[model samples]
Target: MGLIVLRPTRATCVSLACFVVTILCLVSNGPCRAQLSSTFYDKKCSTALGTIQTAVRTAVSSERRMAASLMRVHFHDCFVQGCDASVLLDDTSSSPGEKSAFQNLGSLRGFEVIDSVKSKVEDVCPGVVSCADLLAVVARDASVAVGGPTWTVKLGRRDSMSASQSLAESNLPRATDDLDDLISLFRSKGLNSKEMVALSGSHTIGQAQCITFRPRIYNETNIDDGFASTRRRRCSFTDGDSNLAPLDLVTPNSFDSNYFKNLIQKKGLLTTDQALFNGGSTDDFVTEYSEDRSAFYRDFALAMIKMGDIDPLTGSSGQAQLSSTFYDKTCPRALSTIRADVRRAISREHRMAASLMRLHFHDCFVQGCDASVLLDDTSSSPGEKSAFQNLGSLRGFEVIDSVKSRVQEVCPGVVSCADILAVAARDASVAVGGPTWTVKLGRRDSTSASQSLAESNLPGATDDLNDLISLFRSKGLNSKEMVALSGSHTIGQAQCVTFRQRIYNETNIDAGFARTRKRRCPFNNGDSNLAALDLVTPNSFDNNYFKNLIQKKGLLTTDQVLFNGGSTDGFVTEYSKDRSAFYRDFALAMIKMGDIDPLTGSSGQIRRNCRVAN
Candidate 1:
């Protein structure tokens, strides 16, 4: 049967509202395990939104539809003031079109879901986290939160005090994209075509305004006559005059590859969809992604994982906010129980070590599925400095002091410091795009901190892929994983300062790509040195980095290598062509990477902070 494109009205929004209710109803969990996926989609913020939309779509009367439409909001307001759910307000003074515009921005609506997740976590662990940081975590978690898929989302993102209406308009790609234009837009954000395609797959869910596709629906003068005629009936030519409809009704809220199929038969109603098939690198990507939704889904996930590794906070980053929910801040009554658990964990010893290792795997895998492990450092932002120094004075030991203090008050040293640190790291990394790396079990905690070790071992922002690869190979990591790990550039941001060399100097770059960047770079003398890694899709998980490199738009010299015809060149092309292959390989590589140099089985003591191996 031909597909039905649903144009949400006063009443249809109600059904959409039910989407949230149904999703929330499905989520339930126990203490030990998390049914995080169930409540992910049906969140209050989304439901309330769905209710308004449903009413608008289903309204049988004009007055009713107008009243419901009055309730519609925009991305500008929702994200303007911390995504606090105030964007839904409808005032008589406001223009009806303005209200509709806000409600129509479903692609930018994920922040609301993140806000809800933070609220739940805040309820359990108050003042322990900032909504900004949770927004980053929940962005990744929302995917997992809805049982969609997992990828690392780095922790420590600060919420922007303002949303740039101009920038969002300039940066956010349209539903209509041709490969060239899409590539250009991602490039503006410092992302490549590969990540562009991967990120575009985000159309797997979320709703779009019919106006966005008016050109494709009615004016595709070059398309098949029958296809164009049918689309026009559903979408009018009036610019900015539109209706709300999901990209994929089959799996309206699930992250998948149906969007790709829509493109295959020229069903692509967006300029963006038709752009991929305009016959370029994106065409290959579309072909591959279309053949296997699993591949698209998986690679979409792995690319997300690799992209998460981009410009991440590590060892001593103190700029971002750290969530305190992962800490053991129990009262006196709970201390005893905590200590008992600690003691039991300590007694199992090997089992505890293994358990720590198991949990570490989830952090980075949630984004790009890469396992880039680091010592548990409690500090916010990025640096070689450890964030857990206060732990020592807070208790008697550094890493375990906080845990011990709380545990002592409640269960009294029952929980091992190592176990606590392991759990905290997983939570923190997942908050960003970090993955759980394999740790050698049973490492004893060091009473002292190691500044020298962190500097020597941790990867830096300035390091090229070779420098990073060398560091990994020294630790026995394979080349494939090394290249795969670089994909982390998809999520985090890098200071342009880190890429000035490749952008301006020919010392370490391909002549053509470097020169172009040098000319386009407005601040090579200053800002160039400050360009960051994950500029493109910094909040998304995708393989667009690979696409960016092909365009000479890559910001870092190290970033360009994956596609610069090197040994790992195959990885670049392969990843671009097959999202599934990238997904599986990246997953394996991440788990393996996490395994490197781990403090397993009494080799080293587990420190409470991940930054310090001591």
Candidate 2:
């Protein structure tokens, strides 16, 4: 007879079945990358990334390196669709990180600096560059603008010719997600549920804005008082609409595993984040990540590589540029050799993408995102990069630095930094063979990336699938992809503010989840504004979240919808039935979501760089 493995059902009922056999095994050997350690990258790419990090450090007063790092984090998040650099852009226009202008600023504010640098580079070099290389350089430079740490970067990438708003919407994850959906999203990107949990560990470093967690604190009254009080001081929710959170709270100024501990308690900032431990087959992995901070870091590095592995430039075909602008837009007849070189470079770019896709699958399946391969001393110090007390360990110019290095080597005086930043993101997504998106070139770079832009571009911590779907739709993503990406929440932490809403407003939610939420998220009578999102399993990464809904214990109304009602019920059930199956679907979906409208032969020139399309 075939063996039958029992799937954990109820968040409370699931015996620590511990299906996750300690995911940290990814780090058992050491740096997972090709022996590339943080030290190595710093030494190799620092020159290119230096300026960006400097800009990041300079951008903020209290936490320079942290701010810089934050920019890098944001950039990484936003690149799959367009390298508008919205990730680095925060809601700086407002202290609360939530303002009308924050979301409305558009692409203009986020990537202005890169444009300026590109224009300057153009004067010195011209068309001899590619956008990908420019992005590498500017990412580092942008980090510097915000007061961030410095790192080394390599260049030699090309640009895309178009941009797609659709892929961004469908591919990105929502703030409120469950284990099943989260796993699905990673699977789409060639990732698995365990890795999803590991990557969620990033919350250990950033801070959730008050707006994002207000729902958890104000709506759900049953919560750890101390946890709610500490976060409540960040904002006010009189209007009943606030969505924000600091990516990290424990070592808010640095990047570390404190977020895992936050999950252990009900202190996570987003309802989606808190869902990790709601009860399910994946919880063991969360425990493992929490137990070993080093393991989390190692995995995180590997996951980053996987994320970066997307669409890369391959051999001889992807003719990389020194900057966004390649030298001589009109090719000379005698330049056949150089043109052939460009063609070969472009082909290489495609090959690189295929390679990245393969790596992504490995990262996703082998051990999830604990991309131990990326770990080699990649850790940064707050003092050297950005201060952790305020900003966290994020840096700037994450990719631009690499682009600049590549462009400068070949063309010298022909590329623009602006295009590099833009193109690199496109190529990166493509490298992972993520969804193909359209990228338009000729974008002028600015000297700054706004905090407001970053806040606006990203989804809020409290957003449900609908809210997330809306955000993604605006970016041109499909409902299917929207549903798929929501799964990222399965692993991350949710701030109390974001989770409070569902717990308190019983009248607003679907009945099934509303009844159980009272127990999981309690709202006090006197101070309805003070509450929390989850009572149990706030940090364990598993599918118990679905089981919670089965029992009406879902903290957020949106979460309950995964099982009890709405279009997501089937998906939730399927995910619960078999974790591996969910992982497969999620990986494919991610690939589609990432490809919004990829450029093809003559769709545009094989960009000399990624930031700018040819």
Best candidate according to lDDT: 1
The segments of candidate 1 whose C-alpha lies over 4 angstroms from its true place after superposition are: 1-115, 136-147, 175-177, 188-190, 222-224, 238-240, 249-254, 306-614
* Model 1, span 1-614: residue lDDT tens: 00001111111111123111100000011000112222332332334323322323232132221211221122222222222222232223322311233323543333233334444554444433323333333334345433455554433222211122322233334455345545543442234666667766766655557767676667665455665676566566764455665665456555667777767766665677667765667878888887877677677676554443322211211111112232345332432343444444434431232223333332222111111123344454332234221111111123234444555454442333444444433333233343434322121223222333334444444554555544444333556776665665554444445566566663545576565455546553544232334445554435666666666567766777666666777787777666556556665665444432222122223333434433
Best by TM-score: 2
C-alpha lDDT score of every prediction, in listed order: 0.41, 0.41
**Tens digit of per-residue lDDT, candidate 2, span 104-201:** 22311334444444444445444433334445445444433432223444443323322222334345555555565565455544455666776676
TM-scores of the models, in the given order? Answer: 0.36, 0.41
Deviation in angstroms for 151 in model 2?
Answer: 8.6
Q: After superposition, how far is residue 333 of candidate 1 from its true place, in Å?
A: 60
